[model samples]
Structure formats: C-alpha cells, structure tokens
Target: MPDDCRNIYKTCRKAAGLTQEAAAERLGISVESLRAYETGQRVPPNEVVELMVILYNAQHLAFQHLRETNALYSSVVPEVRPRSVLEASAKLTNRIFLFAESHADRRLLRITEDNVIDASERAEFNAIMEDLQEIVEAALELRCARESS
Candidate 1:
C-alpha cells in the first residue's frame, strides 16, 4: 500500500499548507526525497514515516485548536481531506514506541518495563495511554476539520 501511504502523505502535507520542499526541510530530508515519497518512486523508511506521523499529528492538533478558538475564520481556509482514524492510530502507536526507544528516561523506562510483566497488571501504562490520547485527539481534530469544511 505504498501508493496509499504516498497519497496520505500528500494530503497531510497539503492540509498543513506545506510545500514539498518546506515539508522536506522540516523533516530534515531533501526535497527530492520528499517528492520521491509523494510520487511513490521511493517508499519512506520507517523512521521517516514515524517523523511524518508526528508532523501530521502536530499539524492536525494546531488546526483543531485554531478552529476551536475561531481563529481559522479570519483567514482563507485551505482544502483539507479526511484521514483514516485506524491508520492514524497505528502510526501514533509506532511513534510512541520510537520515542520511547530513542529517549529512554528513567521514569518511562520503569513504566515500560513494568508493563512487560503481565499486561493486565501493569503499574503504569502511560505511554500506551498517551498514544491512545493522541489518536483520539487527532481523530477529533480531523473530524472537526471535515465538519467545518
């Protein structure tokens, strides 16, 4: 489903009002690389996909917050397409794991280690809980964007 991923990436990028070059710069990649990903000439690596998910979620949240404050009405609205909640959620889960693995703070490490023992008796599932929160928040924001349009 690389084509689907490319389409989703393009939609999210446009929704955030970011040109391919701008998005690539933000993602610390080359514009040609971003274009390749968008055109399905090359599939983004897992790390790049994770970065995209973070960017998409952050942008979605910003737009949602703007709309809530009625700030969006003052400007000319850009086109925004809907995103799949399930796909977003899955991406968020991957992002959380990536974050945890990369920046293993003591508190997070303890909580994560505890969760590995008997999933039902986990001491703190904050990471997973936060992932769920991001998913819900992103979905709500996307829904708001859709409804507003």
Candidate 2:
C-alpha cells in the first residue's frame, strides 16, 4: 500500500486472512472499489469503512479512518500509531507516570477551582489536557490492539 493512503485498509484486510476478491465479496463492494480505496484513488464512505472494521475485526481501522478523514478530529486527536498490546500498555503506563509526577492533578484542580481558566493558567491547562489526551489515546490503542488479538 502507498504511504499516502493514510489508513492501512488493505493491510488490515490482508491481516484478516482475506484476499482482495474474498474481502471485496464480504464487504459487498466491487473489487475495483475496494482496490480504489486501498490505493488512495478514492475515499471509502463511512459506511464502507464501518463494514470493513467489523468484517476485518479490526477496531483500529475505524479510529484510523476517522483520524485521517475528519479534519477537526485530525487536528485535536493524538495520532495513534499501531503497536502491540505490550507497547501500548507501556506507553499508557509511561504517560500516567509522567502525568502523576508532574502534579497535573493538583494543577487541574487549582485551574478549575474557580470554574474558569484565567489567562495566566491557560498554558498550563492546555498542557494538562494534552497529557490527559495522550493517556486516553494510549488506552484506546491498547483496546484496539487487544480486540485484534
């Protein structure tokens, strides 16, 4: 698959132990259509992607497709690089440790104590939020990897 294809649609199909013709038939799509999506020649609709996710038993594919296709999601969501369950668990543990060591909980409490983020606290608040997002992303990735397993 081309690197620019964004999501590994084809790879996921193959990983599910299916050939092009077989997967296409299961997806209820023409082989040419599936090929187009895999080759980056066309973007598969959300429904088709959803079908692929279920048919392939790959939850990560749904998240990857969303991240790649939705501009707002792409901007705000952390990129979830595919990794083994072990790798994802380690990443989550590291993120949690870093967050805890940084006293983000205290900072967050202080920042929101007044139910508002004053200008002075905006940067710190953003950093905490980003850290939290990383933790969530790691957990989600782990779930996806476990599902595939």
Candidate 3:
C-alpha cells in the first residue's frame, strides 16, 4: 500500500467517469483523502486498494504495484510477471542486427549493366541497414533504461 497509486487512481476515476468526490464517496472516504492518494502524498491502506479495484472494476495498475512490492502475491500470480523478457528481447534484437551487419560485405557485389539493380540501389540498401542498426541500438538502450528505472 506504500506504493504510489497516483496515476492508477486518476486514470481509473476518469475512465469510470466518476468525479473525485463520487469516487471517494463510493470508497467511503473523503475527497481530500482520495486526492492525497492520487498525489502520492499518502498511501492508501489495503482495504482502500481493494475498494479501488471494486470501484474501477479493474486492477491493472493495482496488480502491477502488488507485483513489484509483494513477492508472496507475485508467486501466486506467476503469469503476472513474465521471466526472460529481457533475454528474449536481447536475443531477437541482436539477431536482427547481426544479420544486417554480417551482410555488410554484400555491398561490394558487382552488377552487370543489364542487372535491374545498380550501384545506387546497393548504396541505398547499405544505408538502410546502417539506419536499422542505429535504430536497434537505440531501442535496446531505451529498453534497458526503462527496465532499470
């Protein structure tokens, strides 16, 4: 319950088309308390979180908090947290770049005048691969930063 429920509370309340006063009334709490919970200035108790789940009729954000905080709840909800997500991402990302990088030598292939593709096409292909490499690297870095944080 110490986990911040700010975004979740706000989003759920908005999605349900309920005003802060209404949502707080449904939970039998004051609007000031609800605001505090949504502002991260206070942590709602477990019962309050459950009331949130009931009020919103969804628990996506609340469950995410539980998964990050309570290992006991996480184990009972194995599919809630997927393992090897990073490993799978790295494997696929590396394989894509490796294939493109290994094919760099292909840029040197000669083409007869009769060939449909000329030097321009070859250069463009190489350029595209280079761009793809950079994009892939950036994606991996962004993912690492997000997961770590």
**By TM-score, who's the top model here?**
2
Note the Cα lDDT for every prediction shown: 0.58, 0.88, 0.62
lDDT per residue (tens digit) for residues 62-86 in model 2: 8888888898987877777678989
Instruction: Give candidate 1 misplaced runs (Cα > 4 Å).
Output: 2-5, 58-149
Error of 1 at 53 (Å): 1.4
For model 1, residues 1-149, the per-residue Cα lDDT tens digits are 33433455677777778899888988999999888777767766757766775666534433422333344532433323345656545555666575567553455556666456456535445555554455555555456444434
Candidate ordering by TM-score (highest first): 2, 3, 1
At residue 68, what lDDT does model 3 achieve?
Answer: 48
Candidate 3 lDDT by residue in tens digits, 13-91 = 7867899999999999999999987877776777888788768755454565565457897665432221244654665
Which model is ahead, 2 or 3, in terms of lDDT?
2
Instruction: Please provide TM-scores, in order, for all candidate models, with all chains considered together.
Output: 0.39, 0.90, 0.45
Q: Candidate 1: what lDDT?
A: 0.58
Model 3 per-residue lDDT at 12? 67
